[model samples]
Target: MGDITGDTRLQSRILEDVGAASHYRAWLVSLALDALGDEPVEIGSGHGDYAAEWLPHARSFTATDADESRVAFLKERFAGDSRVRVRKLLLPSTLDGGFSSAVAYNVLEHIPDDVAALRSMAAMVRPGGAVIVFVPAFPLLMSDFDRAVGHVRRYRRASLRKAFEDAGLRPRVLKHVNWAGFFAWLLMMRLLRGVPRDSLALRTYDRLIVPAVRASERLMAPPFGQSLLAIADV
Candidate 1:
């Protein structure tokens, strides 16, 4: 539910993205929901969809974005919630929030210097805290939509681990998710020409298709997937 720093593609579609894939976004949130320790800070917390879902489980949550408009939206959206704080954050920060957990979902791929970005997230967290990162995976699956969406690079599990290690964090939970999504992206995005907007087709996939993938992966972890989720310790 967050944005990538320095990436403005589909900037105006932040809310649309949240609305279109409501179920899908919820699926993404569920992966890291339990790992989010107290006093969590989420980077690039776009329109705050993930924040809204995760906040009820956390003691305190900070939602941040590089885009001012999205920051404003998050602030207004969470103004009544005392446990939530919204702010504008740029990458390579010196922030020291001492958060128990820091997270970035579909955010790090937009940063060219992902290791430095991970470091920035790690800096905000206290020792023994968690830094949970989720990003699109598989370079072969890179499509026109990914470029149009301003993704710098996709990640593999090993590379993602290296990034965490480079950022001086210890990776604990590293896994591939969305087993079927790898093939779906290959056919729909790589072979297809355009970016997908909010549509019944997406909603249908989110509802009918995604659950089966989630269920299968939960039963047995896939060797590779459409995305990599890494939970590291500071």
Candidate 2:
């Protein structure tokens, strides 16, 4: 997550995909929300989707993005909401924004120096404040879609834990999510090497598959998953 500009075309397509995965997004965000305390800040808040969902829960929210167009969109999206503030910032940021929690979803993998970026997020918050994030899991799942979306690398449990520890953050919740998604990603993303576009198949999965997986995970955490959720203390 350097100061380098993002590929807007690629970003737009990915954001569209997020929009299509309604239940999927809701479940993922619900899990993330449980970890975030009040006065939360999000890094790389693409298209403000997460911010919109998270803002209602947080007393005050800060949403930052490195892309200029995304920043503008975020400003417009949250302009009427006084409790929300939007900023243009890249990872490894120096700003001490005085937030209780710093978060990012599917953002860390884009950073070549992810540990520095995590340290920067930790710096933005007060002591004992949390740094929460959700990132793609399993390097073997690295597909053309990941590259097309600007991912530098996917992560393992140990790798993510090490990153948190190296950044002086103690992991409070570091686990894999979406156990079934691991197989779906391996076949659709890795084997196929194609991006997930808006389609009936995606919506069907969101409707039928997501709920069952989420419920099962609540009962028992799986050994591995398609993604990793990490909540750490600064």
Candidate 3:
């Protein structure tokens, strides 16, 4: 892992915090999982946090990442799990396709050419299969946090639809999520200048605020949010 980036402590911290804010992220991951087919391939599976949730549902779950270090970590993490296979696959590469579904969570923004990346995801899936993606929403919310995480850009509903369309996929579901988190992000990252290190406040937001908005978002799609979830058929 040090080969990719010399900062081992940062890597360790990131892995440790993989699913800390699980209330909202788990909901999003579950939504993506339910949309997948039997043979689903999860691309850019960082730390295998969310991937672990859906692996049992997939008849053949191939967890892939372009980063060799991340793939190695995933392999070791799931060493005894026969249902999952971890592979090092750079996107838009010439590997065997014909998968039932392709999933990418919080990854499209990292790619400089997201449209091409989406095209590759669609190409990997078999016809009639779908490509599901979760991305940060609202370009206006592209804060220092996004840049710190190596995000090149954010996506709006129209822009997200256009990306899938440009990749030759038909958009079936596209909506804003984390409506409450949108305001929270604005307050913390923008107004407050990063989330305070106070653990109790963070827990309150995650345990209470997140679930409340998540349930409400299910009943009605919010006009704006901190993230977008899209399901596009190939």
Candidate 4:
């Protein structure tokens, strides 16, 4: 909805974080790819990062996004890789019941009609196929950063589960993540009432604080932190 694709600084920071999280990203990709099995289509494939990650595992990959520039970038980036294809697509209509599974990571919150979007994602998948989603959690933790990025809502497990159910999908897993970081974000939003402007401070927090919190995730479970992850079957 916003010109987020032009925010090079935010995009760089996000991609850097994704690349650094070998364990977490691998886990997420594994879940989605496993659900997909030999499926060949991917929905909302912004920048094709996840598509690249899952390419080796999938039989073929058709990456689609609403953003035409992103689609062109992905097409050029994966041009030599014949197994991957990129195209511009709107939800529900463009999807039109073609994919074996659909993945909408960190995308749903950006849409106002989150439930309808989930249904559209579900429609893309064939029967028995899955939809994997990731969203920031806790309304109390929503911040200026979220507003800038065009997030319509944050989520809790119950709300997330209900959303999937409303979309006619069966929720397989709905859990909270980033437990340690949750407290930090909560404090920042609820108490500080503003986002920190220091890039160095943010980097230090991500590099140092994230690992410690993620390590704690092994012991602690849902309702822990600031993210909600879900896998649902259509």
Residue ranges of candidate 1 with Cα displaced over 4 Å: 1-9
Candidate 2 residue 57 Cα shift, in angstroms, is 0.9
Error of 2 at 144 (Å): 0.9
Q: After superposition, how far is residue 232 of candidate 1 from its true place, in Å?
A: 0.7
Write model 2 residue lDDT over 113-174, tens digit each, in one string: 98999999999998768899899999999998888778888999999999999888888899
lDDT (10s digit) by residue, model 3, range 138-234: 8877777667666678899999999888888878889888888788778777666673233667767788888888888778989988899899877
Q: What number of clashing residue pairs does each candidate have, in the order they appear?
A: 1, 1, 0, 0
Best lDDT among the predictions, by candidate number? 2
Against the true structure, candidate 2 reaches a TM-score of 0.96
- Runs of candidate 2 exceeding 4 Å displacement: none
TM-score of 1: 0.93
Q: Candidate 4, which segments miss by more than 4 Å at Cα? A: 1-24, 92-94, 187-220
TM-score of 4: 0.80
TM-scores of the models, in the given order? 0.93, 0.96, 0.90, 0.80
Pairs in steric clash, model 2: 1-111
- The best-first sequence of candidates by TM-score reads 2, 1, 3, 4
Per-residue alpha-carbon lDDT of candidate 4 for residues 13-127, written as tens digits (9 for 90 to 100): 4554445445455545664666775565676677777788988888777887766666777889899988877877654443565667787777777766677878878877777
Error at 27, model 4, angstroms: 4.4
